[model samples]
Target: MTQVTIYTQNNCPPCTFVKNYLTAHHIAFEERNIANPTYRNEMIAHDAFATPFILLNDEPMYQVDMDKLNQTLGL
Candidate 1:
């Protein structure tokens, strides 16, 4: 099973988009809000300084690259 993790920040439209996309597709994802220091640190650890940082099976996807996301998920 692929483990999906999404790093997001508050007041981010892209973050909402990603989350909605995943939900609409029935894909299970763990959302890590960057508002939390621990999650922010985790995002920084992945070298991502923006919202909608997605990790699919531990692979990182920065920003809202739907093409890359679809390809990765075999959609």
Candidate 2:
């Protein structure tokens, strides 16, 4: 099984969009909220400077390129 993780900040519309898209597709993902200090540090450790930083199978994806994401997931 491929592990998917998304690092997000609070009240972010794009973050909500991504989560909704994933949920709608029945794609499971682990979300790290950057609003929390611990998760923020975690995101920073990954050198992520933006909200909704997605990790697909441990590979970092910094933007909401849905087509690429879909291809990566083989959807």
Candidate 3:
């Protein structure tokens, strides 16, 4: 199984969109709220400057490029 992690915050439409897209595609993912103190250092360590930052197998993916993402997942 592919491991996916998404860094997001509340009230972010793009974040929600990405989550929904993943769900619709039956992709399993873990969501981390960037606003949470527990994930703050992790986010910083990953150098995620934007909301909705995604990680695939511990590799930082900074944007929601659906085409590339789908291709990466072999979807």
In terms of lDDT, the best-performing candidate is 2
**Model 2, stretches more than 4 Å misplaced?**
none
What RMSD value applies to candidate 1?
Answer: 1.0
lDDT string for model 2 (1-75, tens) is 668999998899999999999999899999999878998888888888998999899988878898989998878
Error of 2 at 16 (Å): 0.4
Model with the higher TM-score, candidate 2 or 3: 3
Error of 2 at 28 (Å): 0.6
**lDDT (10s digit) by residue, model 1, range 1-75:** 678999988899998998898899888899999889999999999999988898989888886788888887677
lDDT for 46 (candidate 3) = 82
Candidate 1, residue 28: the lDDT equals 89
Off by over 4 Å in 1: none
Candidates in order: C-alpha RMSD to true structure = 1.0, 1.0, 0.9
TM-scores, all candidates, are 0.91, 0.91, 0.92
Candidate 3 segments exceeding 4 Å error: none
TM-score of 2: 0.91
Query: Candidate 2, after superposition: displacement of residue 9 in Å?
Result: 1.4
What is the C-alpha local distance difference test score of candidate 1?
0.88
